[model samples]
Target: MGKLTATSAKALTAPGRYSDGDGLELLIGRTGAKSWVVRVQKDGKRRDIGAGSFKKVSLAEARVKAVKIRSQIEAGIDPVAERRKARGIPSFREAAALVHAEQKKGWKNGKHTDQWINTLTAYAFPAFGDVSVAGIDAAAVRDVLAAIWLTKPETARRLRQRIRTVIDWSVGKGYREASLAWPVIDKALPKQRAKVKPHPSLPYSELLGFLFKLREKETMGRLALEALILTACRSAEVRGALWPEIDLEAKLWRIPAGRMKGGVDHTIPLCDASVAHFERMKAHKRENNDLVFPGTSKGKSLSDMTLTKLIRDMHAADLKAGGPGFMDPVQNKIATAHGFRSTFADWINEQTSFPREIREAALAHVNQNKVEAAYSRTAYLDKRRPMMEAWAAYCGGSTGGNVVQLVNKSA
Candidate 1:
């Protein structure tokens, strides 16, 4: 065809699409809405670029716009993206929210979804939120991430990843070209010390003493720490624990997949010591809330730093008494509550004869081998009980009398 005539274009009352050659078409909506679109192949992928509606742009005007778009495509430029740039695309925060909304379904839960958006708001947005996603470069990303790189490495790492995701999404949406920022930012950041890096874990020999010191102070954070150490669960799982997830009759703490790091529901076979600790917490439980260890703010869970501060205060107290305090032997750093998981794992590896898989399962670690994971459906709850009991005994100290008996389960 030699292109569409204005009379023919106006006369066409077709309910479907009518081509005007050179990859241009007039689309008639089911509701009788008439619009123009161009189908162009770029980088071997066909993309439809929308032109103005037929009511607004005449057939001649549509042809003019389509010809310009085709020229841009021939020059290896994406006209749709250029138009978005001309119109001033969304800022980083706006784009991040779009990306966040798009990726929410794949995330483990709503809390993670909130964290994803909140972290960007708190850290990334303050610096680049107002800037267009297309305008963000490696220097901006590095500056933002480097501020917390050494101070808060974990948060900084997550922020970097999220920022990259937003930028990549913007490119996919044709808001920008493929970003050069990713490779540049990756290379610009400082390398973490791989040699000395390990979660600061107290030596197993000192764990008993640490527990004794922890027991001397009575607080919800202290109890939460105890629960974490005894059950070998994550701080989040321990802090977010609700009464519904616990079964005193069965001595199990069933952590839903939403709270677990592995995105799988985990069942912790509670040892006697952990059960006793929970019973103590129940006496002080807020009647209105379900949290096992609710914070000072009614229904809210304890902050992550609450547990950290408890450990730090204990270490300072020990030092005032002229002791080395609870220090990680390898890194010479003060032990963190998280490091207790490592301590638990070490104790299992060194002090017991349990198979590696059972220990891994207790820690809620997903198997690296996909095939084995697919076939291994068991939680090994039975095998883990004795091991946890043994751990509880060790944390209770060898002296035995120091282990606080919070409840009389037999009664």
Candidate 2:
């Protein structure tokens, strides 16, 4: 018998794991999403199998499911795999969900992980989702690819790869006999050329001018955007920044390994200009919240669209004021917040005398070179300090309308 009653389960709103007897658990996420899991030891190996979402499965149902799971474990059968066997064969959607549940632990970026399944949900699911894994073949695969092949090339390409992952997983699980003729699908679909379109970013000469205009707005979004530009960090990093991650006395921002795009802990050497933004944020910090850029809600961070909307508004204002908006001359497009990183990179590559690695380190870019990465254990902190300082100084000084072109030179 379980310790949790329906009344107790419904009343639980706190974000943490709650245990019932017989190894059954009720998980509450930070966002208040609730789900159930049953822990069982099979062959001396422990496993936590998801019973169902709390919304879909009541406390009574979860207890029943937990009992079923434990009963199956006692029969020396794998509950999850046996459930699939009991169903005879999984649908493509079921197999995809199974693969995603197993694979998501290795994927660091939540956005990318969600995108992996979302693309399938959008394109592939409509056609083959309900089809049995055994029924999915070249024609079914080719049909899905053909619909979006020419229209959405990049999405189609990723969709193809994701489809193959699901089908390959099914084959490994013995649901299918062999691999689908991917080469056959390739022949059936039109060839797609990989296109490398660089993100639209400010001209190195115009970045300082753009920053000048950006500083006029003191909203949380703009302040965060300013910090993003000054520090050369990603939008997500700046938005999700917490008070604990920043140290004003030390003038450093330490992003934990899990939050980083590269899955490595990164310490940013803060400049005076970047530090000023944090100081302003600290002045108005909420008593119970730690977010450096908290959204309207107490604990939630700013939405992704907040920064993008700010860019659009500024561009519109500039046009109204008879000035060219913050446009990238090279790309002939309005710049994005993410594009600021590219501007920083272009400035370093085109104008500074810093060693290549120092620039890479400032941006927290993981070196792809295997031999160098194996030996380059140093974080290059001292080298990056001066480079970031120079970058901050370089941008802060340009508070004018005149475009001052910086040339390639040693500082």
Per-model TM values vs. the true structure: 0.51, 0.50
How many clashing pairs per prediction, in order? 0, 0
Give the alpha carbon lDDT tens digit for every residue of 151-215 in model 2. Answer: 88768866987898898888899877566777667788875555645677886678877878876
The sequence of per-residue lDDT tens digits that candidate 1 reaches over residues 1-411 is 437788888888868989999989998866677889888997798867777778989888888899999999999887756865787788888999889887776544455578888889999999979777766767878999888877787687668767877887888887765554454565677866565366888867688889888877567788788888888888999999999999988999899999888899999998887877777777767788999888887668989999898899899999999988998743457999999999998777656667889999889999989999999999999998898888888787222233354332110
RMSD of each: 20.5, 20.6
Clashing pairs in 1: none
Please report, in order, the local distance difference test score of every candidate based on alpha carbons: 0.81, 0.81
- Report lDDT (Cα) of residue 292, candidate 2: 84
Runs off by more than 4 Å, candidate 1? 1-196, 397-411
Give me the displacement of residue 376 in model 1, in angstroms: 1.0
- lDDT at 341, model 2: 93
Error of 2 at 79 (Å): 86
